[model samples]
Target: MRITRALGAALLTLGLAAAPAAADTPSPGPSDGKAPASAGTSFRTAAEIEQGQRATAGGSAGDYLYWSFPADTGQRPTVRATVKLPGTHAAETWRIDVYDGLRRRQSCQYGAQTRTAAAGASSVELACVLRTVRAWAEPWANDPLPGTYYIRLTAVGLPVLDRGLPVSAEVRVDAEDIGGPAAVDGSLAEPLVPGIATEDLADDDSRAVLFGLEPDDGWSSGWWSDRWVWTAAGGVLAALAGVAGYALTRGPGRPSRVPPGA
Candidate 1:
């Protein structure tokens, strides 16, 4: 009995020891499918690069431009944009237009329906908002060929700065489909702590999904973390230890007494 108890204790301790390692392993970060196309090349903003010198009156807010899938082609590209107006902005003065990379024509437009914003408050957001009046757009749907595109802003009708609307346009490419970006390997080699259900892991079609995109053929399909296998191994070790302990502490089953004939 004592031996059995000792063995059980040892196994429980080992199992407890292994658990910390499992917890320490980092999991994967959140992804929106698609891979890195150009070391973060796809997206840009007015302040992100050279400022456009062209100035005009009625410049909406501080000149900024963003792009996204103008039309949904199964996969929609998203961009981050922000706009700033001079002084106290008036209404309906700012306009951001997305142009096709090949055609160089208007693909889509994001216009402010309300009045201009204050110096500090003259910004609106769409999606992927990061500082400024960030918003998102898609030029891919406008049948944009794979190449650099253009974003233009017009403040021609609203207000202007002391030196015309100091309008600027910044642009960049956002996430692509799982196979588009090359940087992403599409693998969950990194474990999600505790235990993520197979269903949840399987449903993700992000860039990481490319890890198993190709048919497995004879090989196993779907993703399976090695962590679970390790845990099962630990369970087996514990069970063996318990059995060994029971055998060591157990006496003869009958508890034999002295023979009367002797």
Candidate 2:
């Protein structure tokens, strides 16, 4: 009876010790799916790079949601926006456009660039792919240059006279840095093309993200992303400690004496 009880207790203790792996996992940071800034807040001249998710500010129909970011040579940027319709109105429509620092609309290849849908049945999704921004390009052509770019979201089909409908929007931009600027001594990556914004944007606004030096230059995906090893190590250490404590409590004593049976 003593042997059976001890074996059962050992198994139960191991089961109880399996919970630390989940506890050791770290929490997410600001860049990982952090909420977006107030909607309708982004502007043409004041647009900034926005990551994760954020809701659009409410206002009349036909309002535009703008976002801007600086692009480096060899970097491919993707901008996508999801707008939730307030109600099922066939008259409502939405569109997304990508523009450069000079306000020239960049061309999109895939089906994500321009889209239109009604509000009642489902939300509308739009994506603009500004393929690799070239470092050196013609001044006449509207090719994408390594500089500031804009994302404009507009409600396309709303009535011209009706007060704008309050539609919520979510914007996500992922700028994958493929390679370096290949420093050219004194030459600029591309001319610092100025934007056409009029509003006086604050210095501390969270809209724009300026990519700095790489943390793990050799890392392909991201630095310190390998979390499984640490999780497994922690769980193993915890289980071994629990087992050692149990063994110490049992000591090297003689086996339990069998009770004299009737």
Candidate 3:
């Protein structure tokens, strides 16, 4: 009991000292997103941009804001925006959309698309997350890739009373690196080729390693590609047609069609 009491005193003393030290340390400010231009229309024309920087700007209710940020390979990109609605926008709704490097709309894997303030509230925040955007995603899949991404904010369904009022918002983008693919095993790896299916590289044959398939083999293994399956179906249909012809010509079990003129 005496030792436990002494240990508790030491822990209390350490916590008190750490509190002051932490308070003395300066915290970082949100200054990463900086617009390069005074005004712009699209992602390419976004004014300020930098990772983790919460750039802010003011505009009228109908104004639109765009921003861009870089998302590196093996990183999960995140975007967040807070809109301070004016008296006119209290009833108006707002949306935050994410786009890829080529200005394509990105799917929201893990975040809210719209953030609307309550009827009496004056502000709302929207958050978005792109889960594990593959660096070498399949060509058919429009998964987010490692490249410049864009965020677009707009106020929709503006009320008649809020057309002329001003509005403001803050936007911040981040690409947090969580780690690479699980198959990597934390080791050095070769470069990745986009659109190359990983399954094609699992085999050791030269065909699978080089071209991802054998020259004489087909990829489709389903019944739709089996010639024998279709042949049997055709034979069944032919038998049914022959029986129907025999039934109609024989007329009530007369002579079961013995060829020439029944």
Candidate 4:
């Protein structure tokens, strides 16, 4: 009996120790590969790039340069951008904005998301660090999920002369995977990437023509969620409690039998 109990305790201890180690293991970062050669003018045309890749483009100061990158669950992505101003120009303010696959603007945790340059300043730098992406989220919650994220860079505040002036911009992104600690119990059915071909929707969808859009496959296929699991568990527990209450509180077996018969 003593040996059996000792063996059982040792196995339990090993199991407990292994779980946390697996959960805490960190995932690999994005590849340090070649960057995109150019950026897109609009969201639909945004040049796709991988994390850790840099992108450069030349355009007018007022142009909206867009870039896109993929992000997985447990990652906290940071976007950095730098704009080189023309030879001579007035003070200008540049800004960088990040949006999820749904085009909803994501709030930055911390970074110089916007910066101003003096008249003689050579360049302005901006960055945005987004919250950790989740495997799944509630329907109402706008938590970041695994998908494609877009970055838009432009001069939000600039003089009229600076609007049409030539400017060069560089953009890059870095995603850090925090591993199992940041992971959720459930995940999305599929990533929020563009599923429909642009040509197929050209004639049927008016929005596609207007915006040059490529829509995402929305949450039609039910996504896996922790709420469903919790609900089922709660229901089972309630049923068990009902059965237990009946067993404990019911009157004793109809008084067993008549006293005379005994």
Q: Pick the candidate with the highest lDDT.
A: 4
Question: Model 3 over residues 164-199: C-alpha lDDT tens digits?
Answer: 677788887766544313012121122221222233
lDDT of model 2, residue 12: 65
The 0-to-1 C-alpha lDDT of every candidate, in the order given, reads 0.35, 0.56, 0.57, 0.73
Residue pairs in clash, model 3? 32-53, 33-53, 34-48, 34-49, 35-47, 35-48, 36-47
Q: Which ten residues in a row have the lowest lDDT in candidate 3?
A: 214-223
TM-score of each: 0.30, 0.54, 0.54, 0.67
| Residue range with the least summed lDDT across 10 consecutive positions in model 4 | 208-217
Say which prediction, candidate 1 or candidate 2, comes out ahead on TM-score.
2
TM-score for candidate 2, please give it. Answer: 0.54
Off by over 4 Å in 3: 1-39, 182-262
Where is model 1 more than 4 Å wrong at Cα?
A: 1-75, 106-120, 126-142, 160-172, 178-262
Model 1 agreement with the true structure over 157-194: per-residue lDDT tens digits: 54443234443333333433221121111232221112
Query: Which lDDT tens digits does candidate 2 get at residues 1-262?
Result: 4445555665665555544533432221124433435543454334344333343444445776776655555456777888776664565567888887677888875646656674364678888777765555656867666666677788765765533556677777666543333212122443444624344457744343333212122212211222334455456656666776777787777587788892
Residue 223 displacement in candidate 4 (angstroms): 12
Q: Rank the candidates by lDDT, best first.
A: 4, 3, 2, 1
Between candidates 2 and 3, the one scoring higher on lDDT is 3
Superposition error at 190 for model 3 (Å): 15
lDDT score at residue 257, model 1, on the 0-100 scale:
81
Summarize candidate 4's per-residue lDDT along 123-240 as a digit string, tens digits.
9999899998888898888898877788999888678877799999988888775554565677777767764343445457632212222212223222333334445545655655
List runs of model 4 lying over 4 Å from the truth: 1-33, 196-262
